[model samples]
Target chain A: MSPLSRRAFAGAALASLLVACGGPGTTTGSSTSPPPSVSEASVPPPAKSVAALGRSVPVGLKIPAIGVDTSVMQLGLAADGTVEVPPIAAHDRAGWYRHSPTPGQTGPSVILGHVTVGSYGDGVFRHLGELNRGDKVVARLENGKSAVFAVTAVQTVAKADFPTDEVYGDVDRPELRLITCGGPRTGDGYQDNVIVFATLST
Target chain B: MRRTGLSAMALACAAVLAGAVPAFADGTASPTPVPSRSAEPTKAPSPATSAEPTRAPSDDQVSVRPSGAPNTGEVTPSSGSATGGLIGGGAAAAIALGGGVFLVRRRRANGV
Candidate 1:
């Protein structure tokens, strides 16, 4: 096979393996299972970065425009401690469960989703990258409550400016932040995270 | 607290990935780690939130449903466009298995 055909086949196969490897994240819910529960008692003490919130809380996620939906799973800090991806594909609607902060609580309920995939044009969060200020950001917790937050601000930060505090900072009110790799694609992935900061609208 | 969370996150990541490595004994795991950019840091922020809210417990029912749930229509592969549903790691790697789309990625950016 030509290099182009070979690469295409390889990429498809690898993605399939990842699906089988991760598959409906034990933490993130897929269409098949009931949403997982997020009990503070079950979750370990907060570590650092969103990764420490080891349990996945989302049952299933949806976006209006793109037909992206996949299982949600809990992702722990990686071997190197970086936050894990949504375990499976479905980039158009793929999102990360901000494992630490509880939904409808005093802190920010953060989620990182994909804006676009390397090849797929309709990544789960592609429109997430298009969200304007005042757009609605909603999250349903495993406990069965859906908290709605309004987009307050949107910015693109280089991977270096993760804004650890700002994104997952201590806040007295319930807040939400949506983050994804943004800006020019660096041959491999995005160079920065497109951050959409939202606060509970009610 | 933020610094601490990042570190904990890294450790948790290690645990998660290590758990997956053995699973890869079946060679089920994909080889795309190096291909994607890192998405998180290595530290923590502060006091954690318990699942049981210290706040009004009764008002928490709204947490169950996601703001949006995936509708099958949005991500399905159509008649003309063959590759639509693939999301992050797994999907990308799946494509690699067939030796398809990603070949273009390598060529699109010779420097990458």
Candidate 2:
């Protein structure tokens, strides 16, 4: 090969390797499309319904099934606009998305937590995938009432294919979504997300 | 001359990989540890006593209804683009390394 062509080839190979590895602020392999919004009429009703609780800030969460009893922190959007997770030092704590409906309110209430922290290990939702249908989750509210929800589903999906609409879409009754990272590890990060869907119990 | 080019390419690749390891780690869902923060013990605020003033329930109260109208004070999730920080860094590295290769070729052509 000509000297000039050899140099060009080397540069091209390096560029391809960099693209395959990905860089900061870039996500590859995940679907970039917007989540589909399901109409309210199309949503199935809860198996057992209860009255929605009035406005109450969630302060703590307890899931007896997975032995989770962590304090809930109010999480707002990060500067990048995605929902923020709890700080690493507080990995044992779960964070409730303040913008979503408060637990027990009529909509999908989101609570996000870490699955693990680098070196620190074992985040609050590390065992979140173990939750099953018919298990119980309790959210202690600032109003001195506890919102009880029964687990409806548990799913682990690739981070690139996160079910945005199904997890964040509006619902007819008060619903709760607990999210954390799980599945196979890709270098330092997990390749998938674990979500627990639940609804208020009668 | 070929050995020089090969060495340069190897060095560039090593540097890019070194920078990428941490960036990949940062891309995880795990929260970054902040220096000044610790997990605060959360306490549920004291419940209102009967002596507290009670306001009449307003129509805006969250209720179990068939309608899917958004609740007041609820923040809708943002449809912001996800951060591809790792990918962006990798792309930048590629461009930088490519530029370095061009610079070397230019120097050689000039007989520098």
Candidate 3:
């Protein structure tokens, strides 16, 4: 075969590969890891040594499983009384809910992000739903300390059926919840929320 | 003649690399670091301490709760495609087109 022909063949073959695997998360362990199956076994008691950290406002977050590393902003109640979200333009960043306990202070610390940013593309949490059990999420606090948490569960539920209590209720140990829009998008916006439940691993 | 083949091979590799960069960028974070210090108990008491139910010192201390879950679904509008797709798809298309043009040029050169 002519040298030119070989080059053309190679180019075409690669283009085909790019198209076949271009979609995000298609080739990663984060998305392909199978969910753990439950069997008819008795549940074990909660870990008695669950550790809690001192109060320190989080300033940054990193989830190695999904390649999320960005500064965290504080989120407070919006004027309508709902919790405020980071500005749309700040789509790449996640926000920590100031009203909740600081990341390591006990109770459930809430963090939120967007799945997709308007015209800007995938937001910081676009791959969050792919987090499997035991994936680590690190939150860097203002005090120069970091709190690392591990995924316990990841659930997607309708916005109307959000598990507020399970998310915000007081817990016996420090926990974290990462939220983002998910499910089908409609006129009212995304119909469901992706929530990742994590407990302090360190 | 040998130089032409080298250039063509270089072009093909560059195009493929452009398309593959983003895919590889996704999981390039360095290994997770160990926390410098374990979570020490907070020395200061929460102002809302009274509202919290009584619990042993080992229990997670209760704190303020949000009135409700955040309404963040609209942070990204529904009408637009991500910029990433446009850039990535555009690069791949450009590379494919460039390759085709190169092949056609080579054929014409041989005919001459």
Candidate 4:
């Protein structure tokens, strides 16, 4: 090809590279490697613990400043692995997955609760949406000790931006995440998922 | 026999070197850093940063009515459609007009 054509091609390729690298978290964000998993080979695994979201879960959740003291239940993915929440009254319980980590245990401990109950006064976790960075989420372990997590960051992700890797990524520090419905209401469903990312502070 | 044990240790070291460790007990963090071998370095979120309500989430809220949107003042955990459908004006107009004329006549004839 002529020098001009070659130069133009080079510029076009450079532009594409720049665009890919310019976005948020493009290289260092949610799209990175998945968090750790439980296997025979996990180097330096955290700890072995258990909670239940099926028929059992950890005790209630409380954040003093937020006035949120609700039960948490164990939650999990259905057959397809989409998030499965406990029934409405199941709030104030941590939805512990039989297969996932326990609160203050190894791996990601996922808990689901209702933001509100239909038209009622809202469920116990109703105020979960109000949690911000540095908020504390305390869960009483079956051992009588409380596992405390402080809110790290809060993001309102469109349902499509769930960031499965990020929300459930494995970190050395204990963490907490609060999920609820948000975004503009639509005929079919809510517009987005309000994902609150927190870390194990206490 | 010793060779087998040695090989197992080698693979474990490789997994660790490849940044194979995940960080949190929960599944919201990246792979665990293998001490000095971890490629990506990230600090555990500090415990004492006061709440910043106005600050944005990492990119990634509350009560709801079991509807398309969450109730106000509650957290919203939702996702967006990855691929958009045909939302062009033409499709919308056609959907409206095609059904519009048919339903209009029905309504008028049924008027009481």
Candidate 5:
């Protein structure tokens, strides 16, 4: 090739090399299973961040959108030092982590439910993955008032990669997190945890 | 001229291979280290402020930070796949190879 053509080719090559090496992130392969449906597409962005309400113990929860209506029980730490889950026998009922802020209080209030209760079949949050953004989740409090939350996002993350900070971390506004086992079950148990994030809407 | 082209091809391949090594490393998901509660700084109020009856202690004050998730799943196997790296890597490698050939020829013509 002519010297001019050669120089042009070298410049092109350098550009390509930079582009290739520029982003090693492209090497991340597609997951074996389809990526967890963690879309925030439908949920409309809040016009304004919701204000927090006064503290009150959550007595019950209702997610009419996904048909989750269950009494909320209190959950403390287990012997293993992890947050507790609702009893396996009453897996249909949801339990709120007492350590977390109450439903209407500032910071994330966590609620845990089961997808399946052994042979008992579908649990209360079996359809939690179906919740979309803009959907409503109502938490009845001991003060005889209810806190309404709008779903912001739903994600199915590997149990090992459970987003502890995002789930339990403090937030300025009152927020709610619904957690349950999801994804294909392996010999160990459910492979992932389905988390639904919501912010106080009303 | 042919020698220059071959040398350029070799250099380009080496660059591509070198780039591919990191790509492979990046594809595998490393186990994330779980944080311990003891390692975290305590957010409790000082003793002087603990006994105030006028203001109820917040939930965080009364409660200990949870160590980890309350997940029921254990020993869940991770299935990581390695792909997509080739598409971008290959295209970039080809362009680099072309560039390498040109540069090599230019250098060879200059008799350096």
Candidate 6:
């Protein structure tokens, strides 16, 4: 083969290989599906309802008040002992901490999402600050059951002073904490984390 | 003609090396580290000296929901995708290296 053709073939082959080897768990920016609108008045009152699964694994999250309906990805801890966030490419998806109790379990189940991705624009939780007390947050479990939670409070605390105990504290009833970076942007990143505390309503 | 063969071999080798770099880097990167907190000793706390008592909510106020049905369906865990990435990168590196070696051997055999 001629030198030019040979080089061209090699370049094409390398490019194809790179595209094929693109990592897993990396979203292609196409998986995000629009969520349905839920209104605060439409939400039912809290009830002692049974969950669908004994150890329900949350697969999706929906907060109608803030217009958030996104798939949930399970996240493990990073090397630095901090919870891992979803890839920047998947800013539309929320990540649930796998180490924590599954939603509907008798402990705090934590769900995290990015507030904003650098250039791609607002993240899944960009409007998380708008959630108010008594808003409904629904977690759809893998077992086809849903865990509905009622927002009790929304607090924006400095990341330096994260209330780890309060967020992850053991509870007799199932609880949920939706976390995202918020407050003010600083040189490092978002200075504060917005945490919404919720209890299993049904 | 010999110079052309040498140039082709060199280009193939460079491509192989370039492909191998990412796989090598991934091989060196360790998996997520698990925290080790079991070494700390559990100590009994002394009784509170403060006059203020910790308020405990009444059982009636606490709501306990029954566990839902015992469905054993398993959801795939999501943490192993990084390993899949490493494997894909390694396979790409191997294929690139093998192609380079085959090209070099063909050129030499052809006496070009």
Which 10 consecutive residues of model 3 chain A have the lowest summed lDDT? A34-43
User: On a 0 to 1 DockQ scale, where is model 3?
Assistant: 0.14
Candidate with more favorable, higher lDDT: 2 or 5? 5
Question: What CAPRI-style quality would you assign to candidate 1?
Answer: incorrect
Q: For residues A1-202, could you state the per-residue lDDT of candidate 3 as single tens digits?
A: 4886777869776984585356332323332332231111222323654678888889999999999999999776554446678877745689987767778777789999988776677788889888888789999999999998888887877667777787877777888989997765554577677888888888
Candidates ranked by lDDT, best first?
5, 3, 2, 6, 1, 4
Q: Count the backbone clashes (under 3 Å) in each candidate.
A: 97, 15, 0, 72, 0, 1
- Give the range where candidate 4 chain B is weakest over 10 consecutive residues by summed lDDT: B59-68
The Cα error of candidate 1 at residue A75, in Å, is 2.6
- Which residue pairs clash within candidate 6? A51-B68
lDDT of each: 0.49, 0.66, 0.71, 0.48, 0.73, 0.65
lDDT of 2 by residue, A42-141 (tens): 2343566689999788999999988899899876544333566777763468888665678998888888887775556667787887887778999999
Ranking by TM-score: 5, 3, 2, 6, 4, 1
lDDT of 4 by residue, B1-112 (tens): 9999999999989988666445334344434445444332222111111222222122211110111222222322331221112223334445445444544555556562
* Worst ten in a row by lDDT for model 3 chain B: B35-44
DockQ of each: 0.06, 0.06, 0.14, 0.02, 0.15, 0.04
The TM-score values for the models, in the order shown, are 0.44, 0.52, 0.55, 0.45, 0.57, 0.49
Q: Residue A99 error for model 5, in Å?
A: 0.5
Backbone clashes (count) for model 1: 97
Q: Top TM-score: which candidate number?
A: 5
Ranking, DockQ, top scorer first: 5, 3, 1, 2, 6, 4
Alpha-carbon runs more than 4 Å astray in model 3: A1-48, B1-64, B75-112
After superposition on all CA atoms, what RMSD does each candidate show versus the true structure?
23.2, 21.9, 24.7, 22.9, 21.5, 22.5
- Give candidate 5's root-mean-square deviation (CA, Å): 21.5
